[model samples]
Target: MDEVARAFLLPSALIWCLAGWFAASRRGLSSSPVFAGCWLLALAGNLSLILAAELLVFYFGFALMTFAAYGLVVHQGSPQALNAGRWYLFMMFLGELCLFTAVALLAVAAGAATALGLASYHGLTLGLFAVGFAIKLGLVGVHTWLPRAHPVAPVPASAVLSGVMIKTGILGWWRVSEPHGPLLSDWGPWLMFLGIVTVFYGIASGLNSREPKTVLAWSSVSQMGLAALLAGLALTSPGAGHLAWLGIAWLVLHHGLAKAALFLGAGLFQDSQGKARGWIGLLLCLPALALAGAPFTSGWFAKAALDAAVIEAGQGAWLPWLLTAGAVGTTLLMARFLHSLWVTPEADGLPTRGPWLPWGFSIVCVLALPWTAWVPEHVRDMANGPLALLSALWPVVLGLALYMALFTRPATAIRWPWRPRAFGPRAAIPALLPGLVHVERRMHRWSVVGTLFMFVIALLLAALSLRISGPVA
Candidate 1:
């Protein structure tokens, strides 16, 4: 690795180490060993990427990170957790397979042994990379795993998974786009269309979900869709690449901090106070509002930058409309989450306040930092303008309106289902016995072999297809 790469390695490695240590020290020996191992593996894999001088090493690093995350998801030992973890692993492995095929094709076309650095790939290779990375980014159909996994993992794990891990796909795409910059324009519209679909799909499903964590998971899906839209705009107009990069970076920072806070808070509320704490419920609204791009929040700056960039690219007309609709949908989801919390019965006694420093720091970071760093100078003058403020306000208003219209009556009438219904215990049995046992006994033994076979089949098909069609005309 070069000096620049080494510089990047140091910070990432240190952060990984700190995260692992923090997680380990929090609960000590009582902590889940499987979870600790997963964190360790992810740290090692991400650090290895910095040292990876070739494609094979990079591929290995990526795979290690992914598999480790999957383990973390299932670490809770619940049936729900395990099912989610299985889905997460299956999707990740599939994404990796697609990526490997694309990398191999790039190597063949370039007549090079290593297409590791990404600057080596050309037009068709870039397209493949885009699709592969999009899968990881949770674009449309490939996004099914995200909603399942994020809600089931331990809180801290969920925070990092949503905050940092998914952005690796965005980082990968950024790296791949470096060389064939202008050529990517051809793929721009398709990416935009896919991104728009993902954004709305997430919002729609999130609104339908009853669980707070599940709604948050779907929110991540929607936020990622916005990121993809910015990336698509960047691809369409190479001159706007810097803006796109900034927007993406802003997204990573904004969503990471905000979602982490929300997930961690959710976990704390559920564990200690039993989700009935009124104040805690109200506090939850902050992150959700920030996520919806409410006025003066970090999300506002991020959304503004993205909106402006798309407009400047002359893709303005429909893209803005789509984004506005997405914002409305997000608002509705947040309102639903808040209403759920409000109606749920409080625990019998007053809740004890835990250490405030950690929670306060996380919330402040989510609320403040992204705007300070990412709001560009060009847009500075427009930051507090009427249009910008109005753009931010309307969504919250629409969300509130929808919430009152649809959920208010039901929320008021319904009582909390505090105790699990009798059928719930029985429901748990079938999910546990067959699925977990099958995975442990027969399935675990054969997974590696089966995965290898599937990988081979996928590669063969890609090769056969390539031979038949010389290249894109």
Candidate 2:
């Protein structure tokens, strides 16, 4: 409907369609009509949310997408898939509840917000929106469901979940809230700092991970954090406007296509052999390299565009270094993922239509993306000159150099400053998280889950009606 909608909708549609094609080509659970229907339903919800001009429409579409994806996550009926679905559904409902409540408050505050500015209406309403969207984005504290869900779900489902679905959080935030305003003076710095923490946390956790899917999931968390940095900068910087949002949108496009390709490639890596195997692995590098901001890649152009926005935001002194660190971290994560693909055991059989068609197309799209007209004309020329080229190239080079010196051989590996064990709270979650086991148990019950589901829908509808019709006398 608007440029903002187009920016968000284009990537969502592209990734979902590609992932859908890849999903349909698979065997087993993915081959079922039920799976296809669920996939379509989820896609509808996703696209609807992006196109939504009304708050109620947005909330309903979000709920539809969230609930429908549970079917995809559990389609295989594996113990792991079932468990992951439970967590996914639980966290999703919690976020939905918060978002629904936030919407009602926003509607009620519409008059006051116009006078005082929306964000200043009430900190609770905005905070609720932030927490709700943050969960969707897979930020640090609320990210437990993401790593679990990605590895257990079918590959195509994982692709869309990470590449497309997670980004709705940013879009939702943009729709209803401003990153900076009188009431949220502290929010910009806070989100920016949290974004940094999330980046390092993802890198450390992903580096320690051997499972390629889990690493990819962690990388999603990191990328979302990078997007947050841009959003926060836009909030704090007076000069920021369309440029900042455009940068974030381009980021969503770049990461969506690249991450989708990576997940799809990961799916096929197990089933591949002979020339097919070689091609899949080789082509996987394009998206991975793009993610690393390697020269001539979409990552290169996207990062360059983001750099321009950061400079425009007047954070030129430190933001470039921060982005460089993220680029280096992404390169390491991709290296870990590529290594796992080689070491992973082969699948018992190939998919029905073979692996190359959808996945190869995805790779081609990722590689050719920058040449497309989706990018702003100004950003198209951001990488001009040798200095700009070097900036893009060095992060990738440093990452590969570190990988060669460290992870490649045991003798060259460094353990001096610290031992190379699993370095994050990921391993210690059960011990660290309060009553997690009990909560997981409660979530497993059908009666409890159904009740919760009904409750959320009813509450959302009630809030919407009460706000729209006014309070009873």
Candidate 3:
């Protein structure tokens, strides 16, 4: 696990450094001291997670990272940034409460704060950890903070927030919970169920959003769902759980780097002019397609591992098929992101060197990472297999087909290779925008969010109860 964390940490550090540079280069933000402070804070958070040997060490790291991200989110100090920061901080503190309690409970039960010691406790403690971490994972119902925060934050901040910060939740779970030894709780199926919900819901929400960053934010929600599914499957199958945990780690690394590339690329695309616009668009699509788990990409490699783990676990027939379907949503989301990028006006000035270096590095990393020696031989083999390649190809094909069919209107007279226009006249902006925003606003209210937090806790308790009670007599 530490090995896997190290692999993840390396790219994260590189990206974080790039993020600070990018933030510093932004026009109005150049003089702000928060960028450097937040960068260090984020750095400290990353180190704490990577080097943590004890539960307290890991939790402190997680907390530092979480709060430090708050500074980045509110860097702009606009109404939107302030609002997003408020919601983000609120959710962060609430999640911290759940996390602190769960960690303390594990420490008390096991008499030590090490992962090995904490694993001895029953699944109920795992459940607490899940509730706490799921906030960061942006798992359904509790995921409102993500879309709000990611879009409003500056590009560099958004990059790290989505790419690196979010994965800490899964890392926290890896540190404190044992999925491979014994099932502490029966939350595996529930985790899977919620994950599936998050996948579809994220697509739905993204389709409705106008901001390109918001669309990407929702896409993160969906990808995190895939990670959660991997985690859930791991928890349920002692035989395959270790393999599944590897898949989880790989998935986060794969998603983080690729998503960071796309976010940074989106910013670049927005800022490019003339030929640079077309070139940046092409660059942007590479990571976007990579994100769809297209063949030969890192997503393909990581997803193959996940598929193998699921099969090895004997989870069910439907899950793999459903996961394939998820690729379709991702395709649509990426397509929308691209289209949004296309229509937006390019920035007037020449592109900055700051984002280019890291963005290019990220793209290079995305393409090259899977082929490195560190990847397992089996994963490499699977990624190269004809059957796996074809399976990966189909979803992207289907998603493109679906995008053309849904977004374009059929010409009155059909011709050979009939081309369709992009987007329905009515579908240009989501019809549900006002309502979704309104709901999110209400959720931001202290009274309402407080209730929602309690509701999440109640749901956690109920899930634990159902697991403990088994079938009613």
Candidate 4:
């Protein structure tokens, strides 16, 4: 690796070390072995990436990171967590398989001259990379694992999972694909469709969730949908590359800081005794607003930049409306999250104050940083205008109105069958199995072996099919 590349990896490695030390010193080596192992594994994976000079190395690093994350998700040692972890692992492995298959195809097609760097391939390679990365990005139908996993993880872990880990997929997508066309050409519309579906589904599922954390998980799903839209725009228009990068960078920075703060605040609120403070409520709202692209916030900058990119690409016709709908959906989801907060049972016993510095600093960053640095002046000026302010405000208002009508109504008056009956042990077994339970269970103990076997089987099938078809005369 080059000196610059090694330097880039230094910070990640340091953070990994810090996390390991913290786990060991604070929790002890004996306690939560799984958690410690996962953390270490993630660290190792991340470090491997830094050291890696080839695509194979990168894939290996990513694998380590993902599996370790899976361990962390299930480390809390609950039945719910276990189930969630299984789902998480399954999705992650599926993504890995897709990525591997894509890489293999690229290598095969490109032959001996293929470069190991992400930028080496185009066309079919790009398609495979997109599918592989989209799985991790939690795009639409492939997103089922996210809602289940995020809510089940510990608060800190949830923060990292939602805020940081998912963004890696975005980074990967950016690295692998080159942008060189008009926006909305080729992959743009498809991504827009995926983004729209993800946005709506996330909001709907979030609204359906009774748990506060669960609602937040769905919110992450919704927010990433917007990120996907921005990414698609970048892909479609090479001219908008800088803007796209800026949008992604801002999204990553603001969303990570803000979401982490909110998740921590939720944990604090859940753990606190007596009445939750007015300040906690206010602090929580800040991140939610930022997420909804409120004026003067990082999200607004990202949204504006993304909009500009689409417009510059001459693909502005549908995106504005799509974005507006996405905003409204996000607002509704945030409203549901807030309502869940209000109704959540207060913890028993005296509340102990946790260290508030991290969350406080994060919230401050979300509110202040964008105004000073991230966004362009024109966009910022527009965000301050009446029309933009109204656009942002109306969604919150509509969400509030909907919440009052549907969620705040008396339980007796609502008559809905959405809530499933609590499962007994017998019922839970069937619930756990779903459709592929038996197959999954049989494969579970032999997961690595089974996975390898499946890969071989798939490759052989492809080869057989190719041979049968012969040369395309």
Candidate 5:
């Protein structure tokens, strides 16, 4: 495998292993074979796709990973979990259809071995890929399922779902788009615009939520937005391509490791008592700070690289400022997460074997990232300068101040899209975007609508095939 595949594959495996251990510790290994089997199968799909040398192998792996994860999402077997599963399944089906159509068109064009011919169908293929990747990345309109799924799943399952699985969307984009240079020129700006919307939408959505996992899920959406932004930069300029992918890689690692830790730590807080809760909060802060881009942390390292990419791409007039603004939103999102954890009612104090060792290992891995040889020397140095440190620190300070002002006021002062219910099976406040959720529900009213959507796609595919095969009658 090449360096990029190797880079993504290793961390994905590491996080899955750690997360599985935590799941077992929390859920008990012997209790259910279903979770274990689905988990391992998903791992295989995630890793194999990364290692796949060909496009079709990658597509099969993506399908495997997507369907297998439904088991994880609905493991709790609650009504809520079942509901979330429906949303997840519906979205995946649509995403897969989009991808299949795109890949098929790509293959037909590539078989001709002519860039000029490939360019002819570039717009259609690019649009299909965008919709497909957007569903997986959980961009704003497609994002309702994420908060729904996260709160209902077991903590470890949630970790891999949020941390590892969403990233496959980014990986899929990289694998599909990297080969065909034809679409990038026209398509790049739109991707960046989608990224910006996702960034702010995620922050706004998460900020309003009171559930810890829901808040973190929103944070994942926002981070994915940043990934999209970096992706846009790469697509915008050939010169910035290498560094932009590098920045995306850094983001994948930083966010995956930190967010997983946050999820695991959230689990630990549930069973924790007074003293243990205090300690758990202490450990959770490391990842929390990283997500907020605290200096010298992996988040800072990744963000700095992105900044360099913006400058390198000569989009310095606006993109960097938007990113800096994103940093402030991220800081507040992190603060909300921590606040949710603190406010969660304590669980049964009867403690069994906890997930301390694995969770601690994850934390160590997170903190150690900046010093790792994998990081560039200059990116590492970005954490050290006096001005650089302030640039990182100020957003965090401002976010905290805003959090105190907004949330600390009287409870009745605010009306969020959803409010926190008591922590339990029904704890998650359902549906962040009620309007979109309504649309999603109406679409699901009958299976025929889904089939009709498929039929439409099938017609599109046939048209593309004919376009490639011959002139229309």
Candidate 6:
């Protein structure tokens, strides 16, 4: 866990500084007082995490980062930016409340001991912790904020938010649900279910998206799902859970760098031209492939560790296949993102200037990490094996085939069945704004949201009681 904190803090510091530089230059916030304030608050937030040794300290760090990010999101001050920031804050507060309540209950349950004590409260605390972090992770049902906030925020802020901040939520879950002395076996399956749902939902949403950043946002949603799956697997199998932590940590590190690179690269690609654009496109594939868990990359290595943990735990055979399918979906989404970058026309008269050094550094990190000691022993051993290689290869192959079939060809246009209009392949996916925005609007209502939070707490308590008691018979 200390290693996880260190891993995150290093990147948080790097990206936070870079993001501030980029936001000032890219978003024209150089003269704005708000930018300075957000920068300070965000720095304090990261410091809190680094200095934290206990629950309250961690919560304070989490809260500072959460609210500070709102300023980053709304820096543009446009209606869309404001709306996205509003939703971001709404979910942020809700998640904080859930985490605070759970931590408070946990401290009380420990009696004289602090929140770090290896004691388990019934399912209530575990459930609250899971849901709270899931909100931050942007897991399927609660993920409305992520896609909105990511696209609306300036490039660097989106990079850091996707890269570093979200991982804090995963860290919280690890501390709360995983450990030696206490077991929360019943909570495991529920988390696994959420992971599965989030994986597919993110892919589907990414496929449906038109904006490059929004597509990347949905990719984070999917990748975080993979993280949740591993965490849940660990919860069910405590012995292997410790080993699984290696996989989780690897995922966070590799994904954070690669995803950050891709987001930053997306910003660069927008205004690039001719030879420069071609070069950027080629560079883009490195992070995209890394993200897809291609063989020999950090993603594949981390995924191998996760797979080994799941197999060691004797989880059902279905999981390995599902994980592979999730990989295929991820590949498809990355393919779409790359395609969008390739085809979309540059903005009218937008300056060609971009932060090339940061993007390049990110690319370097993505390539360098996997080949080093970061690749877990289990992955290192099997990475070259024929079956293991094939398992990784097949998904990318299928994604490429599907991409060629659906997107590259001109004659393969399909009819739109759901909408009143008959549309071509280009128009296959309808705008997601209407339905998703409508749902977010209702969720933003203070009274209704407050009621929902209380209901979630009560429901978790009732379920915890039921689990604690024996069967009625």
Over the stretch 193-306, how does candidate 5's per-residue lDDT look in tens digits?
A: 989998987887777677999999989989999888878878888688888888898889989999989999898888788798899998898999999998878988888888
Q: Give the poorly placed runs of model 6, Cα more than 4 Å off.
A: 10-14, 17-27, 107-120, 180-182, 411-454, 457-473
Task: Candidate 5: give the clashing pairs.
Answer: none
Candidate 3 clashing pairs?
A: 123-184
Candidate closer to the true structure by lDDT (higher is better), 4 or 6: 6
- The runs of at least 3 residues in candidate 2 whose Cα sits more than 4 Å from the true structure, single-residue gaps closed, are 109-121, 178-185, 349-353, 410-473
lDDT by residue for model 3 over 1-473, one digit each (tens)? 45756866876777787666666666656777767788688879877777787778888988998999898899878999999898899888878877776676556655666563334444455656777799998988788899999888888889888988888887776765553346433767777788888887788778767688998999999999988887777767778787888888778778888888888888777877888789888888888988888988888887788888988999789888898889987988888788777889867667554357767877888888777876777677667768888999999999888766555445223342433333442243244233554565566577887897787678556544542322111
Candidate numbers, best lDDT first, in rank order: 5, 2, 3, 6, 1, 4
Query: Ten residues in a row with the worst lDDT in model 4?
Result: 464-473
TM-score against truth, every candidate: 0.80, 0.85, 0.87, 0.78, 0.87, 0.87
lDDT of each: 0.67, 0.78, 0.77, 0.65, 0.79, 0.76
Report the candidate with higher lDDT, 4 versus 5: 5
Instruction: Report each candidate's C-alpha RMSD, comma-separated, in the order given.
Output: 7.5, 5.9, 4.7, 6.9, 5.0, 4.3
Show the lowest summed lDDT stretch of 10 residues, model 2: 112-121
* Backbone clash pairs in model 2 (N, Cα, C under 3 Å; residues 3+ apart or in different chains), count: 0
Evaluated against the true structure, the overall lDDT of model 5 is 0.79
Please report the TM-score between candidate 6 and the true structure: 0.87
**Per-residue CA lDDT of candidate 1, range 1-473, in tens?**
76424434533443343334335444432267777778878867766765676666776887888888887788777999988877787778777876787767655765766754444544444555665677678876667678889878766677767776776677677666644557668777777778888887777666656677777887888888887888777878888766776677667767777777777666556534654355666777788788888888877876777776766677658777778888888888777666654554544566544434455557777666645634567555545699889988898899788666455654444443432222221232233233432332342234653664475466547554754233432
Backbone-clash count (model 1):
0
- Highest lDDT scorer: 5
lDDT of 4 by residue, 1-473 (tens): 65423333533433233333333443223387677677777767766755565566767887888888987788777999998888788778778876786666555654543334433444444555676677788876567678779887877677767776776677666555533334225786677678777777677666656788988888888888877877777766767756665566667666776777677778767766554555687778988888877766676766766666666667756777777777777777777777778677776676655546555655676677575754566456556668776777776677667555455545325544542244221223234334333432343344643564475456434543442222111
Residue 418 error, candidate 4, Å:
16
